[model samples]
Target: MSIQTELTEQLNRYSVDFIRFVDVSALPEEQNKGFPYAILFGIALTPEYIQEITNQPDYIQQKIKREAIHRDEFHLKERKTDRLADELADFLTQKGFTAYSQSEENLAQTGSYNEAIQQTSLPHKTIAHLAGMGWMGKHDLLVTPEYGSAVSMCTVLTDAPLETVLYSPEESMCGECQVCVDVCVPGALKGKTWNIKTSRDEIVDIAHCTTCLRCLVMCPWTQRYAQRPVAVR
Candidate 1:
């Protein structure tokens, strides 16, 4: 098998729900960090946890409880993605390509903020969107056909000339669905549709967002993902 195909098949063992290779040369140097290629991958959140969060009472006490669940799961899944990215980077390095894994720790140390774009360094969702794995949702989250926004993503950059699938940037598939906007208690969601030029702040106000995950839980696409059979997931 070709190296790309072999590595892709190996990702199953790493619990990757989706993976894509994309050329990021067009991105700003600050974002791509001079890497021409990026591996963008995501791991879907546990359906059971999502269901619990979605079905729980919205009272303050219950909201806090579900928030705790959301926080813990996010950290757990983020760590898993971080480790997977590091492993993939090492694998590519062994294959003679210079690779750099974008670890949470490294990003944290670098303070993550890209002042120009008003976002964190090398947004994983942007790469995922470029890879045709997803589109930016109304809530400013990457909404995938398979996992919706219920996924944790990470990135690995390399100089390797790996295979890629080119696609035009996707427009919002959200249509008139305003479930996320209506469910957002903090009024963070703007109910706006996203396009290539839309900035994240245009969809949601980060300052007002409580990170309570109400938007995520109420999303129709995410609900569909949560309803999928466990075995199939």
Candidate 2:
């Protein structure tokens, strides 16, 4: 089997919802840390959990339940993605390639989502966009056609000679969709349309966000994921 195929198969064995090998050499050298390639992968959050959080009537109660779900379900999937990253890195190392997983450091900062975003040198959202797994949403989250923004992502940097795709920063797919912006109680979303040149701060005011996740829950793409027939895993 091809190395890329073999690696993808292994990731699938671990229930990775999405996987991509991408050439990250286009990123600033300091950002990628001289790694020519990266393995980007994600695990989806439980739709039922998201639905419950989305359907809660009381805003305060929704926030409370969202925190519990983030702690139990979201972080648990993050840990799972971390483990998969480590395993993939080890697998590459065993084959005489240089590999490093970023999951452990990112997980350490998972106590606060905003903190994690602030501290990450190469955000997984950036990597996911580079990998063509998704586009940047108006809410500044990576919105995949499949799972929307409901997937927790992980990354592994490597010097392995795995085949990789190179894509220009894709144009945003979220055409005129403002559900996430309108639902932001803190008015954190600026209702800006994203393009390759648009900065995260242009679309979202992180300082103003309370991380209430109303945007995440009300997002139409996320709703599609939640309402889709459950797959028998």
Best-performing candidate as measured by lDDT: 1
| lDDT on C-alpha atoms for all candidate structures | 0.82, 0.80
Give the lDDT of residue 21 in candidate 1.
92
lDDT of 1 by residue, 160-232 (tens): 8888878898878999999999988889889889988887888988888777777886788989999987675
Least accurate 10 contiguous residues by lDDT in model 2: 105-114
lDDT of 2 by residue, 1-233 (tens): 76778889999998887888888887888678799999998888889868876876254445466775445576688788888888888898898888878786534554313364454667788998888777888888888888878988888898987787777777887788899988887799999988878877898888888766678767888889889996699
TM-score of each: 0.86, 0.84
Per-prediction count of colliding residue pairs?
A: 0, 0
Which residue pairs show backbone clashes in model 2? none
